[model samples]
Target: MKLLLSFFLIFPLLLSSQSFEKGEKLFVEGKFNQAQLVLENYLKSNPNHLKTLEYLGDIAGQNKAWDKSISYYKKLENLKPTEANYYFKYGGALAMKSLEVNKIKALGMIGEVRSSFEKAIALNPKHIEARWALIELNLQLPAIVGGSESKAIKYSSELRELSPVDGYLSRGHIEEHFNRNTEAEVQYKRAILIGGSKVCYQTLADFYKNKMKQPDKANKVWEEYKNKNNKGIK
Candidate 1:
């Protein structure tokens, strides 16, 4: 009788461990549908499983099931709201939802995306992607909808401070689009000086040749780019 009780107690544990392992493997392989089914079944048996909730969120996100993903992530957040990655993923899922929906209705989702990203940033100030996304969203949004150049610049500056080397290009983008030619030129040059990029060189060439009508400078930049990339490549 004692032996039977021991086997019964161990059976559920063994089954749960196997199920979790298989579900994780499926999740990693991008088999989200199967993973979701397996995870949902596991959750039925283990309602408060934190890891199960986290993985369910991931699977939902992968499948682009934003509402389901949010539901799972919220459960995880309720359990532990301090986790930065959870907030980031949640915010990212919201952003993806905003993109997937039609444009007219998409703006409605922006508020949720903005709020989620803000919460993520508040929880982890160093989250670069969240900062950049917020900046991009603000820049693209209409002025009537609370977008402002000053806010974009603020976030851009924060991004630069956090990641100086790659941030120069973002500054260039804002300047170029807003018609701040001199500032844009300076930023593009700074980006090239810090770490050479083919795209940066091409951008500078385009700015000089077309926008500024400086063919000599453009030709020089293009030549440098070509020489660096085309050397001994047949």
Candidate 2:
């Protein structure tokens, strides 16, 4: 009787495990709609399952269902208050939602969006993406509303200390945004020299083609990258 009772009690857990593993596999394979169906069914039985909620939140975000994404991430943040990533995802969802809403509503959400990112940074002092987000936010917002080049540069400087490539790229981005093409070009070149990665090369090439109107330079940049990569220079 005791053995039968133990098996009965463990059966549901085994089923749940199989269900979630299938759902996670589907999610990893990018069959998000199918994964969502399976995961939602599992969630009905395991409502507070953290990985299930996280995968659902990611799928919702991928589908551009920002409100639903925010709801899941908010629950995650509440459940795991010390987890930096949950706060970051919650803030990212809020930021996307803000973009979809009216200007007044977006303005209303700004404080919370900023706070969530800040909270993530507080929890993880070395959070690179959070710093980048703050840099962009400061640069994009109107000066009257709180935008400041100095603030953007502050984050860029921090990035420099963390990763030289990101620092130069971000500084270049800021300069490009301010219409300082020459300064931007200098920064981008520095990044390519230091990193020589695909993104670094692409960033400089795009700047040359689009911003500086130099298609020949862009082509040359691509060719250079191909040649250097073939030679195993980077």
Give the alpha carbon lDDT tens digit for every residue of 1-234 in model 1: 999999999999999989988988898898888998888998998887888899999888877899889888878778888876677777778777777779878888778778877888898898888877777778888898767778878887888888874478778878877889999999999988776778779888999998889999999998888887787421
State model 1's lDDT: 0.83
Off by over 4 Å in 2: none
Clashing pairs for predicted structure model 1, backbone only: none
Q: Estimate each model's TM-score.
A: 0.71, 0.96
Tell me the lDDT of model 1 at 99.
Answer: 77
> Tens digits of per-residue lDDT for model 2 on 1-234?
999999999999999999999999999999999999999999999998999999999999999999999999999998999998899899999999999999999989988888898898899988889888888889889988777999999989999999999999999999999999999999999999999999999999999999989999999999999999899887
| Model 1: CA > 4 A from native | 1-4, 99-108, 176-234
lDDT of 1 at 23: 89
Q: Candidates' lDDT values, in order?
A: 0.83, 0.94
- The TM-score obtained by model 1 is 0.71
